[model samples]
Target: MSALARNRVGQYEVASDLSFGDLSAAVAAGWRDFRAAPLYGLFFAAIFAAAGIGLSYYFYNRGELAWLIAAAAGFPLLAPFAAAGLYEVSRRRLSGDSIGWGPVLGAVKAGDGQLPVMGVIAFVIFAFWVILAHTVFGVFLGQSGLGATPLQTLLTPAGLGMLGVGSAIGGIVALFLFAITVVSLPMLIDREVDFITAIIVSVRVVQLNTFLMLSWAVIIALLAFAAMAPAFVGLLVVLPLLGHATFHLYRRAVR
Candidate 1:
């Protein structure tokens, strides 16, 4: 099949004759495309970080654990915005458009209308995971007739064992969830794909490139840690670079 006739799904070029070498080339192309717009990326990152800090401060000042709860609850509400910049980067790169703040904002704004729907979907998914996690914890740890408080029971060997098991289970579940969703939102935005398809594709990508994706995940976590440590000021730089890099990665995986 001609390259022009290739079916594009998210970033993947769906042609039967495509080779791993071609895929690698696509990934390299994506990285090169992303690097072309470093300043634009920095600008988006500044906006995202500022908004995140403002929201975080608002939650902290309220002192209503409910606000923190709600903020956690509303995390998916903000997922679309996070995906917006990445989508903008990918779209522009694919179209061979010059990157700039104006076009990026325009593209994101055009797509902003979908955020609510995506947010709702994200909220439901997040809620389900939270419920499942808590249920698992309660079943495995709470049922252990250790004591009144899990912490108090931790003074004993059995309690420690239970705690370790619970922690390990929780960690595994969290990692699984992260792997499923890491590329999903951006894929949705970049390709105008539905949420479910995007998520499934993302999960497939993670399954296909587990070690590489895990390395990327670790890098993201470390960058996030550094950004959050300094009153989140570092996020202005880190968030955008990561956002752009994520788009680059998404492009690499699909095509």
Candidate 2:
């Protein structure tokens, strides 16, 4: 079926023989496009960053410390669609369209209906991730609750163990989710395909070049972690960078 396919939606992307070199080229192209139209990227990223700020402020006031990890990790999961506008920027740049907020945002609004379906998938995964994270903490560190500050939990042996265990489990979930969305969002925008097909192709592409894709995942994780260091301000830059990069990366991953 893959061999007989015309559109690179489900099955496998027969046109692609992706490699690590593609990842490198994608990042470079992503940076070039971002520099060309920084405003588009900034506009979309700012919306997400502001939401981050709002959530942080709300949680801080309410003293919902346990929600912190989920909030931090979940934003990245939400990035695929949140950065739809940025992806549209990359699409416009590739097609030589004049970049304007009206047109770019309109393009995003006009994207595939399947985009929202993908969002539902992300929401489920995020909810599961948060629940699992809470469970890990509860099982390992509940006896001697981490207090005053969340960082204080790391001081104990059980706390350290819980962190280690939780991180590993979270990493697995993150990778699986990444595989399903890595190329799917851009593909959904670029083609007339359903979300399920896009997701299958996305997973197949990752399987075809597992090591390269895994490296891309690691790079995304590191950039995201570093970006959070500046109190979520860094996401303003990191989100768009990765968003635009993922578009170009998808191009290389499929026909």
Clash number for every model?
5, 0
The prediction achieving the highest lDDT against the true structure is 2
lDDT of 2 by residue, 1-255 (tens): 544464354444533467767778888888898898888778777887788778777866886655666566655777767777778788878988777888677655444567877878888998899888878878886666667666877867887898899889889999989999988888877777777778888887787677888889998888887876677788878888899999998887786
Tens digit per residue, CA lDDT, model 1, 43-79? 6666656776776678668753323333433332343
**Model 1 Cα displacement at 128 (Å)?**
7.2
Task: Provide the TM-score for each candidate, comma-separated.
Answer: 0.60, 0.90
For model 1 the local lDDT of residue 194 reads: 60
Question: How much lDDT does each candidate structure score?
Answer: 0.58, 0.78
On TM-score, the leading prediction is 2
Sliding window of 10 residues with minimal summed lDDT for model 2: 6-15
Error of 1 at 147 (Å): 22
Q: What is the lDDT, from 0 to 100, of the residue 232 in candidate 2?
A: 73
Model 1 worst lDDT run, 10 consecutive residues: 68-77
Candidate 2: stretches off by over 4 Å: 1-16, 109-112, 149-152
How much is the lDDT of residue 197 in candidate 1? 65
